[model samples]
Target: MRTILITGPGGSGRTTVAAATALRAAGEGTPTLVVGADRTDTLGAALGAATGPEPTRITPNLTAWRPDAAARFREDLTAFQTRAANVLDLLGASRLDAEELTPLPGAEELSLLRAVRDAALSERHELLVVDLPPTPRALDLLALPEELRRYLRRLLPPERQAARALRPVLGRLAGVPMPADWLYETAARWDVELAAVEAVLGDRRTAVRLVAEPGPAGADAVRTARLGLALRGLPTETLIANRVLPEAVPLHGLLAQQRKALAEWTDALPVSPVAHLGHDPRGADDLAALAVPGVNTGHPPVEWPVVDRTAEDGVLVWHVPLPGAIRDDLDLVRRGDEVVITVGGFRRIVALPSALRRCTVAGAALRDGELRLRFAPDPQLWPR
Candidate 1:
């Protein structure tokens, strides 16, 4: 399935674009699901459909939903609290209520991401179009898989030969209930769910379409979003310049100046396969016009960095290119099953592909600004 995420700074017409894209895809005989990630329920209204958390059919093969993040947050908190209560009870503690399990800060975004993953995996849709929040929040959602995986991996224990050595000693000291086994099992379950999300997000067919207005700030936001996505192996496919003034407008002083500035900014954008649409992008017809080939906004072709994997002499070599980043400014962090790279004042958290998580880091080197990390297969940690 192909997944397209449409996002940009607020007021950039992302919701309209997303709805239009969904309509076009459905017109082409593809089952499309458009999800509104924005807190405002404007996407459905733009499409002239009833707004609700449940999927509303807009076309023969098109459906849209404005998921209630607050409601989902409450439900997720309840479920988590119930599980925590059970686990706490097993350890001879009092049960805790859902009120105590309210999400701290990032929990709401995580829940939204879970909803997106579910839409992607649903057999009812062939294409998933996500109308994400503004650029910053959208980037956070994309980076979540790596962040959660890292935390889970660190909290859980290795279960093979290492467990043989550690469990016996811990079991003897604890006397009755062993917490390591439970922790490992919980971690394993999380691992499965995270892997499913990573698979859907990291697929090449899953592309991010950056929507931006013809202005300096909008251009910068798009650039940052593109760079962040690329660092995480999720590349931006199309740069959509929304709300551009038409050429027919009388060319004079201020009006001409604004048009020239827009033209220059559009040309300067980095990612290629660009397209331009009007400010008043209204219905499916307007969107269909924008999706037409050869809109040509003049951006460079996007080349995604590859993660090269090789197993040699019992060590797995992972060569990650950290171009234009200095070693002194780089921060490498391993949180559970995720690796975070901070370089050149920019940070990107990456979800380790399933194959790499089975290995332990043998050594790491940051030479000439390229961070290369080596890992060795850890048989003890490999799931049987």
Candidate 2:
């Protein structure tokens, strides 16, 4: 299955583009599912159908779904309370009812991400089209699985969980409470779930389609978004310049600026200009007429590998592709088995390959949008 995530600056008509793209794919006889993250019925309006948490057939081969974040939040909290009932009873704590629960700040995004993961893994749909939040929020949402997995590993290392039988004995001997068996079980389950979601995100069949209006703000947003996406090694399929004014419109200056933006985008990725609809697009026919082109999915970037040059320079170079990274904002550090990379405001800690872990960072450089680090093998650590 191919998963295409569509996002852009808010009010850039990304949902409309997403609907049209799914409609086009369905028209070609592909089984396509369009998933939306909006709290309001934006996607339903574009598809001219009512959508909810359940998947609804919008057309012959297209299905649309809007994740009910509030409901999911309630369900999750209620289940959690049930799981911890024993502890709550001992503490005389009252369990909150689901009816009184409301979704917290990031609950909607978490629900949307879970839906995306499930849809991507399901065999029912050949194509999954997701209408993600605007660029900033979407980036954060996409990065969540990896970040959470990292936290889980740090808090409850799997190695420690392996000795579950000794936990009680050790806790009694130390006269302190170790993590309960249920806590370890919960961590293991969460890690598995997060790994599945991360797999979907890092899958070769998944790619991103960026939609933006053709103007200064949109251009700036795209550029900033590109840096973030590149740092994460997310492949961009195309740039959809949505709501482009016609050439003959009274706003000739705006049209000229759009032309310039389109040309610039063409050089970066496939540029597909969606003309201004004058009114919000409604119904399948209108969406189909919009002619939003689909893109071929590209495999995500390969991992940074150690290129040994021991014979010539006694150095190993690790090459990491960061397409839009600014040289001034880049930072690299080697900490034990993990290398911490900071690009702009985003940071990721990636574990080094076994061979690279025995080496020390000698120097680093950002050239041609790729960050290359030179490492020297430690004589004492390298296998004789």
Candidate 3:
């Protein structure tokens, strides 16, 4: 399945563009599902279809759904609360009500991501177009997998025998159960779910299209988001510059100033192909016109090469070909849960795969424009 996620700052016409893309795909007889992650009926209304929580057939090959992210948030809250309560009970704490467990600020965003993953995996649609939240929130949603993976790894099991040895003693002294096995099992389940999500997001077929207006601020935001997505290994295919003024606009003082600003912004942007649309693209026809070149024919701008996994010199090695990358401009940093990479004036943040994150980086090398980073098995961090 292929998923195209459209995101930009609010009022940048992301939803409109998303709707149009879906319409064009559907018109071409492609089975397309457009998901309104904004929790608004704007996308459905544009298609001239009645909006509902359930997926509505807007056209012959197009379906729309305004997923109730709030409902999904509540469901996730309930599940987490139940698990927390079980853990507390096992530790011999007083019963706590689910209502008392307040969710963190980003909980809803995480729930929305889970909903998106579920929708994409559904068998109902061949092409999934997501009208994502605004840039900042969208980045957070995309980063949730790495965050959750780290949290689960820590909470499910502690490092060292000292942690395990103290658990029983502490439980006995405090008159609690201290069931470590249950925590491990819970973490294991979460690991499986997160792995599935990571796989989906990491797939090159899943493309993120960033929408922005023709201005300095919009360009800056797009660059940041592009780098963030790359860091997380999410493929960002195209950048859309919406709301460009018509060429026929009369040159007045303010109009001239605006035009000059747009010209400078366009020139200053990173060296990536961008699509420009006149005004906000709303309704089916507007979006159809704004469709990226070759998108309707299933050709994407960025093509990700396949990686080969094999063993070399008694060590497991995976070769990912990143052709055309300059070795001199390449820089890498291993942060807590992410790998920050800078190459040829472009930066990308990459979330480490579970296996790689657990292993220590044995060495790194750049040869023939291919950067190779080796990871050695860390017995201490590996799952039991």
Best by lDDT: 2
TM-scores for all candidates: the values are 0.72, 0.95, 0.68
**Candidate 3 or 2, higher TM-score:** 2
Alpha-carbon lDDT, every model: 0.69, 0.87, 0.67
Off by over 4 Å in 3: 80-104, 158-182, 252-282, 289-384
**lDDT for 209 (candidate 1):** 81
Mind giving the per-residue lDDT tens digits that candidate 2 earns over 1-384?
898989999999999999999999998889999999998999999999989989999888999999899999999889888888888897899999988999999899888888888888899989999999999999999889899999998899988978888988999999987887777888898888888888888888888889999888888888888878876768777889999888889887888888888887787777888888889899987897796986454555445567888889989998887877889998887788998999978888888878888888889989977888888999999877
For candidate 3, the TM-score is 0.68
TM-score of 2: 0.95
Question: What are the clashing pairs of model 1?
Answer: 149-337, 150-335, 150-336, 150-337, 150-338, 154-336, 243-279, 272-300
Model 2 per-residue lDDT at 266: 82
Clash tally for model 1: 8
- List the candidates ranked by TM-score, beginning with the highest: 2, 1, 3
Model 1, C-alpha of 339: deviation from truth (Å):
7.8
Candidate 3 lDDT tens digits, 131-151: 888987887777777678878
